[model samples]
Target: MTETVRIATLDGADSFDAYVAWPEGTPRAAIIVIQEIFGVNPGIRAKCDKWAAAGYLAVAPDLFWRIERGIELDPDVEPEMQRAFELFGLNKPDDNVKDIEATIHWIRREAGVPKVGAVGYCLGGKLAYMTATRTDIDASVGYYGVMIDQMLGESHAIAKPLLLHVPTADHFVDAEAQAKMHEGLDGHPRVTIHDYEGLDHGFATESGNRRDEAGAQLADSRTAEFFAANL
Candidate 1:
């Protein structure tokens, strides 16, 4: 089953919408589906339903609600892509992370779900990494998370398991950044970085031209396995 829900922020003055999906029976765990630059659009909601099919309750929050009530962009459209970048530039990720924290707390307190994990793509991917380091999320998966090399200092706080999918050919994250990420996090016991040779960003998206079937399946299987083991 799928439904729309409202999540309360920590400050109590703000509340945002979230799209939720549930399995037929009791969920084994709860998975927070973080959105990319696009808001909780069809692709993101589809991901939540996919997790539901896998016996995990899933929710996708509208993190962009801070800047705009609803934002759904198409990567293939030039204008939308420009808007997405603009939204990305204007987005306050730190504040959005707090919304994720609130969502985690909501799942635990209201839904009675003790184990909660998160998976994200694009900008969501970066947030997932931040979630791992900042919050008590049980497990986190980031697919081609951008700008992660810039935040290696906080890696020390990552107590739970984190799976990062790195596309070696990602233009957004060049060789130097990837090298820096590896140098800082490769040996960390709680972190695992999987490199997809010759692939680029968005290869694991649920739909669109960016989706590479083989690469998506490989990365997704790894994500599923990682969540199963850790969450």
Candidate 2:
């Protein structure tokens, strides 16, 4: 079943809503689903539900709550995309990491799940990578993260398993950036990188015209296996 819950931030200065889904019985693990620039929309919620059906306790925190709660934006809408970017700019990377840290704390306080990990898409993808280098999560998966090349310096800080899904054709991550990322993370024992040859940015987003269903399925299956093994 799925429900909405309020969780406090690291400083407890404010609380944000997180869409949560639970497995039939006790969860084998817990997964934090970070949102794209679109916020906690249907896609993010569906991801949580799918994870729950797979026997993990899943939660997607409202990262955009500090700007506006319950934000559901369409990528095709220029104004909405603009708003998403505006909010993105205002929320520092450190802030996002703190919210995720608080989420980890909240989950540990409220649930008895054996392990916790995270999976993120688009903007959340970068957050997931940051989570790996900064937080205490067991594992993390990032789907075509942006500006990850710049953060590769922290790759050595990753003590937990990390999986990265990169679409070769993604405009946000050009060949140069991808090459840099691969150079930094490819041979690391704890890191796994998968590249889809011709997929575009947001290719895993079910609603986008650029979505590559087959690729998404394959990446998702790999993610499931990675989480099952590491978490």
Candidate 3:
């Protein structure tokens, strides 16, 4: 089951709307699932449910709550894509990090989990990387994050285990950016980067046409392994 919950931030703002899901027993770990530019839609909700079933206290927050609540995109439509870009472009990465931080705090305290992990996709993937650097999460996984190159310069400060899943044919993130990410992660003992060939962005979203079952399975296996090892 899921419940809408509110969380307070370091900036003295009450600005997060989150969907919290827990397993039948005490959670072994907690996870903060961040959303894509499409907001907290069915795909993200499914991810939260999946994590909870995997024995985690999973929570997915509507990161766009600062701008609008429940603003989701129809991935099959170009107009909806354009509108999503327009709305998301109005917010900066810092704003997204604040919301993520608030969600993390709630997961650790209110969710009653001893340790926490995070997983994100697309824009949420970038936020996952930022969350690792800026928060005290035990582990973080980012899938096809477009802004990874932009954040590479700050990766040295990351102290937790970070797993990045890249699609070889992603339109938004190219080969050169993947090379930059590798270089940024160089010598970081806790960082693992994997590239799946013939996969595109949104490979794990079952509702999207780009979803590749094989790629998503591999990513999910690797992500679970990473979280098991780290969290």
Best by TM-score: 1
TM-score of 3: 0.96
Residue-wise lDDT of candidate 1 within 1-231, one digit each (tens)?
898899999899989999999998999999999999988888899999999999999999999998998789888889998999999999998998899999999999998999999999989999999999999999999999999999999999999999999999998999999999999999999999999999999998889988999999999999999989987
- Per-residue CA lDDT of candidate 3, range 1-231, in tens? 677787776686466678888787888899899898888888888898988898988998888877887787877789988988887787678888887887777776777677989999999899999998998888999999887888877787799999999998999898898888888886688888998988889998857777888889999999999998888
Residue 94 error, candidate 2, Å: 0.9
Q: All candidates' TM-scores?
A: 0.99, 0.96, 0.96
Steric clash pairs (candidate 1):
none
Candidate 2 error regions (>4 Å) = none
| Model 3 residue 169 CA deviation in Å | 0.8
Clashing pairs in 2: none
Q: How accurate is candidate 2 locally (lDDT)?
A: 0.91
Candidate 3 residues lying further than 4 Å off, grouped into runs, are none
Error of 2 at 32 (Å): 0.5
lDDT of 2 at 148: 95
Expressed as tens digits, the lDDT of each residue in 64-123 for candidate 2 is 877788999888788988988887887777878899998898888887665899999989
